[model samples]
Target: MNEISSILAICGACISFYIGAGFATMQEVVQYEASYGSRFLIVILVAAAIYLYTNISFATNGNRLKLNRGGDIYGVYCGVFGEKIGKCAAMFFDYFSAFFCFMSFVVMCGGANSTLTQQWGAPFGVGAVTLTVLVVVTVVFGLQGIVNALSKIGPIIIAMILLVSVVTSVTGWGNFTGNLTKIDQGTYADVMQQVGGGNPLASGASYGGFVILWFAAFLSELGAKNKLKDVNIGMLLSAIFIFFAAGVCCVALIGHIDATAAADIPALVLAEQISPVVAVAFAIIICAGIYTSATPLLWTAVRKLADEGTVKYKAITVLAGAVGCGIACFVPYKELINVLYGLNGYLGFVLVFAMVAYDLRTKMSLKHGVENETAGIDR
Candidate 1:
């Protein structure tokens, strides 16, 4: 791909990957950041700063390393802490990718089933099966197919979200003010305590950490295929886009805090107020976002286990999808998400710490070399 197309593809992939079932449905925002009231603003700004720096680092460092397997970079940095432990952790995280993707797939399936049943009286089983089949077919084609699917779906979802956010903000300005008033009445301490584990800073930091883990391997592959400058620019643009889109969405959701607070699909509730047709349209967009997100995740997990373009790889993909569907059907989707993702977020923090240490050491070494070279020239 040319630089422009590569950049766009990277941008699309980043957005689509991050805006999974919870994000598109606004459940992530509502739970992670929004429910905290005024504290969410702190979360947004802090998380954005961390996201911007981390994503740029992921691209640049990943391009420099040119990793063959995603876990290889961990081996490079984790040498100080017993290579065996590091490699084991890396492998563990790789396997965890499947678990994460599986949960997301289930969440999306459940979301689709609920939306369809509520809107059109469609059977939940039918919706779940249909979404699972489509996702499986998309994953069977491998990385290129996943990227193509996401590149198409990502922009449409972003546009629809931006439109909904803007319109809702304008029409619900009064409610927005009312919500803000409600938030202002509560102390920040009380707000954070009520939200996630009584610590707003921890919640915000975990959000950044969890997101970095999500993109670590996937972005490494993406960055390897493109020029460093292009990847850097793409990441910068993607960060800005997310910041704007997220801000608007959060504002929209807060506008009708009471209704959305209890909603399974908060965005759907907001959309329905505008029109039933718009709500249905938003549900489709949610499914597309889910597909885009799940495709890469499934590919990432499968690639770890089997070589691409092989019969074994194809077989694994189908089997994995089938297992995932069965799990989705049996598990209570929301409860699984709460437990799995919450635990993953903490684990992700450890990886973030390692990354920061490695980066700082590398920078200091480069600076030391530069100073020595200058002294030699002076001599």
Candidate 2:
């Protein structure tokens, strides 16, 4: 691809991957961000900053390291501690990340089922099966196919979210400040249960943590394939778009905090307040977001198990889809998101620290090398 197209593709893929079922549905936003009242901006800003740093680091370093597999990123980061520790840490991250990815796929399926049932009164199986089939088929085409599909679908889904959120915010402008006042007054204590035990900073950290886990393998792989400059630009754009979209959605949710706090899909609830037509359209957008997110998550997990396009890989993909669909159909969507995201997010924090250490070590080593070269030249 040309430079512009390449940049857009990377930007789209990263944003789409981040804007998964929880994000599109606004459940994550309500719980993790908006629940903090006026401090929501601070929480999201913290998240966006982490996203900017980790994404650039992963993509650019992946290009430089040229690792054989994306998951090997853990080894590189953990190797900072020592050889034995690196091996253990790498293996733990591989298994844990794979498990997290699969569970995340299940969350997507649950989101699809919930959206369809709530919006259209469709049978639960229809949404789960539909999403499963789409994800499985796309994954079978491999990473290039996944990226191509997401690069197009991602921007469309993001636009729809922004449109819905902005409209909701404008129409409910009068209620926005009033709601923030109530939150600040502690009137909605029962309504706004904090994600990180009432600490916005911890909540923000966890939010960044889970996201790092989600992108670690996926971005690394993308970086290994694309130019560093393109990856850097694309990831920067992704961070900006994600933070802005999330901020708008957070404001929208805050405007309708009373109703949104009680609902499973806050964004859909807001859209419905606008009109049934908007609600239906946003429902479809939610499913699309889920698809884009699910495809990469499932691919990341399965890619760890088998090489792309192999018979074994195809078999595993199909099996994983089937299993995920079955579990999602039975589980409560909101509860699943809370348990999985909350726990995995904290684990992601550990990975973030490792990444920082790795970055510092690499920069120091480069500096040392430059000094050695200067000494030789002087001699």
Strongest candidate by TM-score: 2
With a 3 Å backbone cut-off (N, CA, C), the pairs that clash in candidate 1 are: none
The C-alpha RMSD of each candidate to the native structure, in angstroms, is 5.4, 4.3
Can you list the residue pairs that collide in candidate 2? none
- Return the TM-score for candidate 1, rounded to 2 decimals: 0.89
Task: State the lDDT of candidate 2 residue by residue for 359-379, as single tens digits.
Answer: 887788787883221110101
What is the C-alpha lDDT profile of model 1 across 153-230, one tens digit per residue?
787888898888888877777887778667556523332223357366776776666676667667776666668888
Provide TM-scores for the models: 0.89, 0.95
Alpha-carbon runs more than 4 Å astray in model 1:
181-195, 367-379
Give, for candidate 2, the lowest lDDT window spanning 10 residues: 370-379
Assess the local accuracy of residue 324 in candidate 1 as a C-alpha lDDT between 0 and 100: 69
lDDT of 2 at 331: 94
